[model samples]
Target: MSGRETGATAYLLREPAAGDVEGFAELHVRVWREAYRGLMADEVVDALSVETFRPIWSSIARAHAEGAVVDDGRAMLVAVLGEEPVGFVMVGPARDEDAPAPRQVWSLNVAPEHQGSGVAQRLLDEAFGDGPGYLWVAQRNSRAIRFYERNGFALDGTQAQDRHDGVTELRMVRPD
Candidate 1:
């Protein structure tokens, strides 16, 4: 019982089964490694594994399987080019108390080779639907910041630092 799809790729957005968990986890790791290398700490990047993505995807899959749908709801969208997953965008209601209601992009990642092919943009278009959206990006991730900016997201001047991880993040938002 996942959210409804809006385009020709509806079938690609199907509810993920328990078995799909592994592929989802693998995609997360692969895309992160391919997309974030050099942008993030090599140690942190190398330390990420399927184990880290497992719980994250498992929770999303479970929620998509059981959560109630809302008006302007949000969900995860994985884009597969042929049989291989090339990108994924996790979107939903803005959880940040500082953000406007409606849609938020918790994360968006595309394989380095597959980027600029509209995979990420298509996923965002489907999930956010021209609505107001917000996302947090690591401050050091200049590439992502540019991407977000190019997509119309503006810096909202919010910042936070992870005490344990020491990563700095900036909040960006877009009006509907």
Candidate 2:
């Protein structure tokens, strides 16, 4: 789906292609640095590098292209404006043993310039579909928490520290 956003031509959300790996990696690092700036340590944010994630994104794209990801309901959707990727979402079956829902939103991000342009909403709708699901968000990311709440997710009182960086995260669930 696509439309004009603000004044720019809006983005189109579609399954990621192998050629999109580099773009996805770059966007992932950019969004994480911006979104987690004040909520996480500078060192941690600075450590985010596209080179560090390119291989992983490439593997996922390869799996997706080979039709090996659908059985697990895993997918990576990219939102492209013109020829550049402005955002992406990764989702799949929940990994937590105690999760209330079977699906989990592993990541959802939009370029700061694209915020409030319905890109995130479209991504969420496509990722979660019409089913119960959950996601973990940084506890201090009030903007994201509010966005999830507005989209039908509510905090389920579950919290944990990210193993790699020790940042606290809270679980939110949408049971519909």
Candidate 3:
């Protein structure tokens, strides 16, 4: 695969395979730790075990391996560099009762090493696309907030505290 806009190494952007469940768990934990370390409590960030996330990813990727139809608009795209997943994005229907949009970017992350290499942008495009949606990002994650803003998101003045860790998250919306 050719580079979309950045990144020297080529990567393939596609839906996750069943075999990718473990990789997703591992990368998700690693990226979460890197991105949330200083923003959240050390114990909270370090407590995100890969074992806990594996079952969740397994369920998400199960249908892909079973050849099931993906009728729901939900999508989870993975950016794979060779045999490893370097980035990923998960988008689906908004979860909030008073959501700004029907679609939401549930999660998006790129390995710290691939942050500015455009892997995150590519994953965002493949999974969420250019649309009127929303996402909740950590208030202290300046880098991620900037990236989301560059991708057309604007702070909507709404905020929430994570139930698990109690970190405040700001809601950003992309309007139609």
Candidate 4:
């Protein structure tokens, strides 16, 4: 909470700024390469490294400038580390026709350098906010599966195709 700890050590999760776009997109490109290199096709992941991906900052800035809040009944959380934007999680109503209700994690990504540092957990804590929610992860992403399991999410016996890579994924959920 102090300036010293925050700036040098502890990560500070906050609304991202439009200025953060380029940096975040850079981090995203790097981290995705680290986390998905072998699990996904190299060409597909490489495509995401383009400059247009910099919209990350603009997207977060728009939501922040609009005064979007957790209690505002929407589900989008962007995590920042000190002066740098590092990760983001977006949640929205479940889109699957068989889902019982609305409210699910649409996406979650953390910079590879920041993973295992409790950043994703903090993001999930904010996104779930005292309720049940669901998310999907590539079935082959054993690391992420363990991370979600540690946070109390369980396999929901559902599966889907990942639109970006055409990989099979499992739907997982945590009920409050």
> What does each candidate score in C-alpha RMSD?
4.0, 2.0, 1.9, 3.2
Better of 2 and 4 by TM-score: 2
Off by over 4 Å in 3: 1-6, 68-70
| lDDT per residue (tens digit) for residues 3-27 in model 2 | 4353345678888788898888998
TM-score of each: 0.79, 0.92, 0.92, 0.82
Winner of 1 and 3 under lDDT: 3
Off by over 4 Å in 1: 1-15, 66-72, 100-102
The sequence of per-residue lDDT tens digits that candidate 3 reaches over residues 1-176 is 23454546788888778899999899999999999998889998978998979998898788777767366788878888878889888898989999999999999988898889888888888777898999999999999999999999999999899988889999999999
Count clashing residue pairs in model 4: 0
Worst 10 residues of 3 by lDDT: 1-10
Deviating ranges (above 4 Å) for candidate 4: 1-8, 67-72
Candidate 2 has a TM-score of 0.92
Alpha carbon lDDT at 102, candidate 2: 89
Candidate 1 TM-score over all chains jointly: 0.79
Q: Between 1 and 4, whose TM-score is larger?
A: 4
lDDT of each: 0.72, 0.86, 0.87, 0.73
Cα lDDT of candidate 3 equals 0.87
